[model samples]
Every structure is written in C-alpha cells, then in structure tokens.
Target: MLTNINFSARQALSGVISFSTCTIMVLLALAFSTSAYATAVKQAPYEPDVAAYRTALFLANMTPVPWSQINDAWADPISNTTDSISGFYALAKRPGGSALVEQIKQALAGKDTQALYAVTTRVMATALLEELSRAHNGLEDGSAKAALLRATALYRAFEDGIRFLDRDGYRSTGLAWLDVNSAAGSSGVLGAGTLETDPEKFGAALSIISDYIATNYAPETFTARLEFNAAPENIAASGASIHLAFTLPPGGTIDDQDPFPMLVLNFEEGHGIDEADLPLVAYGDMLFDSPVIFGEVAQNLGVSCSTCHNRSDINRNFFIPGVSHQPGAADVDGGFFNPLFNDHRSDSLDTPSLRGIRLTGPYGRDGRFGSLRFFTRNVIVNEFGGAEPTPFMLDAILAYMREFDFLPNSKITTDGNLTDEASDAARRGEILFNTEYKNMNGQSCATCHDPSANFLDRRAHDIGTEPPAYKGALAQAFDTPTLLSTASSGPYFHDGSQPTLGAVVNWFDTRFSLGLSKDQLADLTEYVETVGGADEPYQAFDDVDTKFRLAFDELTTFATTLNILIPMKDAKHALIMINTVAPDLAADASTMKNLDAKPDVYRLAGLLNSVASHIKKDDWDAAQKSWNEFKTLQDAVAEGMF
Candidate 1:
C-alpha cells in the first residue's frame, strides 16, 4: 500500500511535465503559422493592373492624386465617389480607354457621370459582341456569312462610339463603366464599399502607386535623344579634302590670316560659316598658325586634323587609310606620295579623337598625357614625323585649343524636381562619387579624375592592365581623359574596351578600384544618365570613308595654304629645320633633348631626328616601337601623370 501511494505522486509529476511540453509545442507551432500568414498577407495584396494604371497617369502628366482621397476610395467606393472618381476619370482621359477603368469604378461607384458614360460604352460594345455571336453559325452558309457582316458593322459602330466619346472628352465615363462591368460580372451587382480609414492602409496604396509610376513612366521625366547620319558623297566631291566641314559665324576669321576669297571654295560647297564653326578654325589656326583650309590637295594627300586624332563620330578605326606598310617596304619618306604596301602585314592601332577634348583630360589614346599643348607637340614631332612650329605657332595653337567650347545650353535637365525618394537616391550617389566608399582600391572619384574641373585631371596614371595585351610600362602609364562630354563618347575606355560609361565606372570599381555597392552604384549611374546633347542637328555625312579621305586632303591643302610670314632672316632656319631634318628625327624622343635648348626648333628637329633614327636603325620594328613609346610618354606628361 505504501509503495503504491509513492508511485502515484511520481506518476502525477510525470503527467504534469508531459502536458506542459505538449502545450509549449502547440503554442510554438501556432506562433510560426501566424507569422507566416502575416508575411503572406503583407506581400500578396498588390494589384499589378492598378499600379500600371497609376503609372500611365503619371506619364500622361496628370496631377497626382491626393492621399486622403485615394484612401477613401480604396476603403469605401460609394462615399469616396466625388474625389476618387473625378481623379480617376481625369487620369483615364489622359490617354483614354481601358487602362484606367478599374480605378475609376472603385472611386466613382457607378453614380458619377464618367462612370455612367463608361457603362454605356461597355453596354453598347457588349451588344455588338452578342450580335456577332448570334451571327456566327456552325453551318458555312449565306446566312452565317451575312450575319458575320452585320456583326462586323455593329462592332464598327460600337468602336466609333468609343472614339467619339474619347474625342468629346468623355473618356473617363467610358473607363468607369468598363471598370464597373468587370467587377460586377454578368449579374451586374455593384459590390458595397468597405471603409478603411487607417493611415497605414492609405500609405500602402500610395507606395504601390509610386512604385508603378517609377517603373513605367520614369523615362518620360527627362529628354535627350541622339540622332546620327552617314557622311554625304557630294560633300566629298567638293574640292575640300575632308567631306565634313564645320562652318564659322560671320566676321569670324581663321585668326590672324586675312580672310581669303578662295576660302569659301576651300570648304565643301554649300557649307556656310556659323558661330559653331569658329572654334574649329580658331583652334586649328592657333595650332598651325595659318588658316586651316580643306580642299582637294589636302584630301589627296590624306592630311587632315583627323589624321592623327582620328574621327570621333565613327568607331575609332585606325586612320591608316586603304594602304598598309610591309615590313621591308620602301621607307615612307615624309615626302613619299601615294605609297602603298601589303594590307596583310599591317598592325592594328588605336586612334581616339580630339573632339570634346576640353572635357576629357590627361588626354591621348593611352591617357598618358596631361596637357593638350604637350600632347599636340609630341604628336606633331613624333607621330606625324613633321616639322615643329615656331613658338608663335605653338602659342597660337594653344590659344585656339583654350577657346574650345561645348555647344552652349546643350546639357539635359529634368522637367521638375524628382520625388523625395528619387532625390534621396541621387543624393546618395553624389556622396559616393565624392567619397571613397568602394573596395578594390580606396581612391575616391577625385583621386583618379577631379570632378570640379569637368572631371579631368589633365594628367595620366596607371590603370593597370586594361587589356591582356596592354601590359608593362608602355600600357601602364596612361593619361586621364576629361569627362565633360563623356556622355556622348560611348564605347568608353582608352581602348574603347567598355561599351558604356556605367561599364567604365564599374570596371574601375570592381577591377581597378574597390567595387561599389549596388545601390550606391545605381545612384552614380543615375547622375551620369542625365547628360544631354545640343539642340542643333549634328552634321550628316555622305560617305564616312570618303569624308575621312577628304579630311586627309583638306589637311594637306591647309598645310600648303598656310603662309608662315616669318622674317626673311629666319626663313633659312625654318627651311633647314623643316626640309633638312629627317621627319623621323624631328619626332624622336632621344633626339628631342638635342633640340630642347631651342624650343622653336624642337618640334622640327625632333621629328627629323626621329625619322633619321628610324632610317639609320634600318629596323622598322625599332622605329615603330620608338614612335609608339614616345607618344605614350608625351601623352602621359601632358595629362600631368608623368
């Protein structure tokens, strides 16, 4: 008896413990189910169509709906009819038709005029549909065909009615009717409205509408479109070497050089001078110290501003023309005319342009140069194997370049202030641009390119191996190009390796610099996307290749037409330097030092020396290498990285 009593106590204790454990398990499961249900409820209630309708409204430039009204309609359709229904009707009328119907009904409750009109349109359309259905017969007979025709006519009438309503500014009414019909179904019983007065509910609806508007209508907020055309053949036919010619404004002379009567003929026919064209002449004359002429002679010789810099409009294909130089081919003495060689033996080369150079700094293909003056000097001597200009000539060119300006009032701007959400995102991006928030390398935007001065450093720096082939000291040192008009200079990167600015920035972030956070990067991209284009149309080209050829011709013609009015006493110095010096020698870096003491003679002497060195070295390999290396170094120095 005593043992049994003791066992009962233990059993009771065991039972109590088991009951507690089971109760706890049940509670845990219930809690989990409730949490999951809550999450599903939160995410599942969105109506995609509703969101889209809101977006269409925004894009159509309709005024935003008031929060209070939106909430009232969402909660109780009948009572909120005045505000919500009117707003919905207005939105539907913007683009008109089915898009805004559902929203309109929810606000109007069939009582609004707009809603009634919409219902009438729907009823008429349905009647036409019913007629069509009756006309269709399984039997392929005359009656069936006749019925079909009648149905088609009725359908047309219904469509006409819809069009008439839209034109008469009753689009909101039609849309509201359609919405009511859809919700009521065949029974046509209007559902009673449920009033939801909570602010949280209203906020949710606003969020949904905002998200939809952002996704669908965001593109309409800004305006900047690009249009391109090929070069024209007739332009090339003119005596002008380069098919394309930029015009200058009246009274604008190509600096210092008295306006010549033949100047009109120098450019392509029908090409008139304009204010925009002045900068080109001003820049060219300052660099060449003579009015730059574009004519047949220049085109035939393949000489043009584009000869070294290449054309910016076209893909940066090398400007070597249709000819190629064979390894052992007769040396291209600067004086040689129409030299042709094996195409198979040619080497691919990079040919970035000088257009928009003012915006891009640390200039050059390799981004090795910092200063435009330095880069220009080096190219004249080393790359072109040409005579260097006198100090006056150099000064003129520098002055011209300094005057280079982007077309005024060309930047894109948003129509209105961005919503608070968008503004916040953009601000975040601005901060990222100004600070070092990325990971691979810690340099901020300023570390590489300074944003204050058109986002250029006017200097070159090492960007590591942008390409597998680009390695060693030669590729390592590159100039920083300006970012002013970078928005247009697509196929970004020194090698045109990246296709877009976003890619360029991303490459720098992930591969060169520390990678950026997705949000931060998005912000940066948004800012970049706002860059705009000029109002005037870009000059159309006839045949780009022909234009390219003309560029060469114009370049030669310009060179010949330039009258260097140096004193007779200094003529010999000019002649000896221009004629006697080997074109290669004039461009040679090693020989550059010998001519440096005489700055005026440096370009001519350096080019001559570079040419002489190549010829004497008898190794085209060494010659080309020297030329390329010197150019890289020159560009680097100009950009101030060196």
Candidate 2:
C-alpha cells in the first residue's frame, strides 16, 4: 500500500539515539552498574498540559475538524498555562517546534483540511521523541518522570498503526516503554520509598524507542500509514445533539468539571420515579446507558443507545463529523463506527423518539423490520456492532421501552383530536385531515396517519419522498412515523429533508397536487402541530450537583439486578452488571462536588469490580460477600456524595 520514499533522506536525528558500538557499550555498562538502583512502583498520573495538548492535536485531525473547540482545549485556563501546545513545545525545547506549529497554523488558515491533518499528526508523533529525550536528560527530577509519562501517552497516538504495520516492532516498542518506566524510577511523595534512577537501563531502553520512532515516524520516513491506527478524534461538539443519557444539555468538558453535564432523565411522568419499583425496567435502563455493550470504537468512546436518544427523546444536538451530515442524524451503517456494517451509502437518517415506542410497530424508517426484538437486535449486532443480547436482556429492554408513554397533552383528547382549547385554524385543519382527496385515489391524510390510532397507520407508503437507490430498484416505501410527539422531534421525513411541520405540509400539498390556498396550508400545519404538542417537550434540569447525586443513586438501582442474577447463578449477566456500574461509579465520583465523599464512592466501584473478579473465579459466595460490602459502602456514602 505504500511506495517507499528515501529511507535516510532529510531524517531528523538530533534527539535520536544512534546504535554505534561505542554508544551501545557505554549504555550496557551504565545499565549494569546502576541495575541495583532501579525499583518498581505504581504508574504516575499524566501531566494535564500533555493530556490537553494531546486531545487538542487529535481533535484538529478529525474530519470536519472542530477547530474552535480544539483551540479552546489547547488554551484551557484550568491547565494554568496559556496554551498547552505552546507549553509542551517549550518543555520539549527541541528544534523545529516553531516550524511545526507554524505549519499547522498555516494549513488551518488556508482551510486545507488534509494538509492540516497531516501536519498536526506529524507533530503528535514527533513530540513523543522530544519528550523521551527530555526525560532521558533529567532522570532524577520529578518533572523528568512526568516527561516519561507524557512520552508514553504520546506513543499511543501511533500504537495502533505500528501494530498493524509491524507486529514485531509493536511488541519491542511496547516492552521498551515499560523498561523506560522502570529505569526512570519513582521520586516517591514526601521523601518516602524513593527509588534512584538507573542511567544504564534508561539509556538502553531509550535507544530502542528512539530508533523505532526514527525508522518509522522520523522526518524522512514519516507517512500517512504510520497514523492508520490512530484513535478516532471526531467527538460531538459541545452544543451537538449527541449527549450523555443522564447528563444535562450541552454536556460538560471531557475532564468532568463542575457545572459539567449531569444526568437529566425524562419518563412519562413529570417527576423522577424509583427504579427499584420496576426492576426489569431499571436493568434495561442500565443496559441502554452501558457503552461496553458495543464493540471497539463505540465502547472506546463510551457511546451507547442513550447517546442518540437522551432520556427516551431524540437528541437534537447529537452529531459526529463524518458519520452525521447534521445534528440529530447519523448513518447507523456508516464506515465510522463499524466497517462491517457499512452499506456503501450515505443514508443518514433522523433519530426517532423512543417515547410511546410500544404503540409504534413496523420499526425502521423503511418499515423493513416487523418485530421490535429483531429490529433491536439488528441495531445492536449489525448497526452498532454490539454483542448479541441474551434473551433476558432483550426482554428487560422491551419491558423498559414499553413503559415509555407519550408526553401528556391537555388540549388534545384521547381520540387524537383537538379539544375546545384548540385554535379555530386547528379545528379547520382537522376537517382537511380527514377529507378524501382524488389525485388518483379517494384517500385522505387521516387514512394513512390514522389520528385515532396515535397518528400512525402502521404501514409503509411509496409517496415519493425520495427516488429509488438505482434504476430498476423498487419504489422506496417509508414507514408512517407517529405524529404523537412530532412537534418536538423536527427535521421530518426518513432523510430529515423537511425542517418543520409547515415545510412537511407544503411538500405534501405540492406533491399530491392538493390545490390548497395559503390559508388552507396554514390550517393543515396547525392541525398537525396540535396533534403533536405536549405540555413539556423535554425534561427540565436540576442543578449539576443534584443531578450527579441522582445519577449516583440511579446507578445503585441498576446494580440491584445483581441480586436476581447472582441468585440465578447467571454469571454472564452478573459480570455484565458489575462491569457496567463500576466504571461509572469511579468516573462519576471524580466529578462529585463533595471531595470528602470521593474515596467512599471509589471504594464502592472497586468492591463491585472485586465482585466481577470473584464471579470469574466461579466463587459465588465470594461474589455475594463482595456485593454486600459494596451495598453497605453505598449506604454509608449515600448521604455524603454529590
């Protein structure tokens, strides 16, 4: 796939370690002399400057790159640095930093997408070398240890590519990184248990990594192939429709800070309910929010069913640059999430609301699926590349989904008609809705929509919403979407081509030759809006801290399923339950306002993970014992956490 450029031309070798005989001999001698000085310890935390710079650099490479947010993340004030990128450039103190930065800036200024991506990624790979060199220069300094950590994080940018392109190289480079960490040693906190640095081991390990980078990602050898396995960078924008299931709107920073996004659930009722009262539904809710259900990229990014459908409603702000053509829409079978499911098409569809899902049958925009179970399974396995759900999991999800009632409406009656509170225009439009048209048949809008049946006829219609995919292809018959909460879920039609109810009415009026006047069109739009209206279209938010506390409690409710799973000896589901709840507990705890309660929350997560380990060992008694401890700890911290 790659044509070789010169192997040794224009190679930047200043920071690289040459494997000359004398150099190798010197390194080996130092390593042996200082071997006794090296000691093992737990890994240290990454510097925020390096972390922020890494995020910003990756963001800058994504398709339809979010330049503004990348800039903000780079210059995040909380980093206590004017710009993380600049700070890192200074820290590395290596030549060509200014030139690389300028190249990225120039490419961005020119709006040259490919050039910017290439240059930005080159900077990411090269920065790893500079940090490693900086670490080697000062092994005993605390900052040197941090430099080593930064170098490890930076290598991940190209880790995948290296594995794919050269497997043996991957193993060597990976092991060398561990060696470097061991060689660097630990300074320890408060002058306790400090391990002195081993210069010999550090130099030898440093050479392996430096040579690997030089041969693959140096100035002369660097190519796009080296970045093939890089992590996905197309994160949803701050105001994008894609949101956290239980989080507040316009979710928080990636770091999880105060006033950050918090969970905001919306069931049929205007208030929250106790999940313990409906155990199966509660388990289903947990499954909906658990990203581990999906494969690779989705799981890595923490995406789940609730990402697109926030609180059972469509997430209007959800978007991924390459996968989504617009906010609130995504090509489920696109190459972004899973190439196995790519249909070789750009058919991004509008995400439908899950509210009143029980009444809406013949799932999918094309109405190709007859059973909800089959459709749900297809979405998991084929669409998002998730594992096939167990029957119990499926049943639980169905039970939870069936409980999704439409938002309450006051002006509309049970028969799907407006009451006396309706405007005169709506009443007039209601007549038109039921009136027979004679374009080619004596059918009316109500014939297909069926107002009394929650505004759906449970049928597909070839009304020419769009052309067939190819010549000789069958007419595209789209499922009739329910109008129950249509007013709140805009951008109508299968492809989201219509932006409003009025636009939809206008399209139909023109398409079917409805020969209606302007006033008549307005009336028809009004009628449809009335049928779709709800008292409150979305859930109102509580303060961030309160939302986090509610989420903490809800997570525990999700864990209650462990009681049934363990008793049934269903280790599979039990382990799934534990894995799902544990990570959230740790992460959510980190963002809690009550710093004092953080430790207990972390302990709760650790205990749950311990339970999973016990289940893996087939120790039911141990698992149960751990679960009980987890519950006890939860109760203790319940009153103290945010």
Model 2 scores worst on lDDT over the 10 consecutive residues at 33-42
Poorly placed runs, candidate 1 (over 4 Å): 1-301, 307-350, 353-371, 390-392, 407-428, 467-475, 512-522, 531-537, 540-642
Question: For residues 168-202, could you state the per-residue lDDT of candidate 2 as single tens digits?
Answer: 67788879888888777876799997877789998
lDDT per model vs. reference: 0.35, 0.66
| Every model's TM-score | 0.34, 0.65
**Residue range with the least summed lDDT across 10 consecutive positions in model 1:** 224-233
Best by TM-score: 2
Give per-residue CA lDDT, model 1, range 1-642, as digits (tens).
535433223332333344333234433332222210001111111122222222222111111112333333223222111133433343343323344455445534533332332333333234334433343331233243344333343333222222321222124334433332232222224645532233333233323322322222222222111100011112112221211111111111111111100121122223544422443343353233211122211222323343322222222222221121211111121211111111221222334434445557666555556678787775454443345655654565555454344332133333212234344555566566678644636677656556555556666666763433434435445666655444554555544557677776677667644557887677777655433223331333343322223322232222221123122223333232223122212222222222233342234335434633554555445444544554454344432211
| Deviation of model 2 at 601, angstroms | 2.2
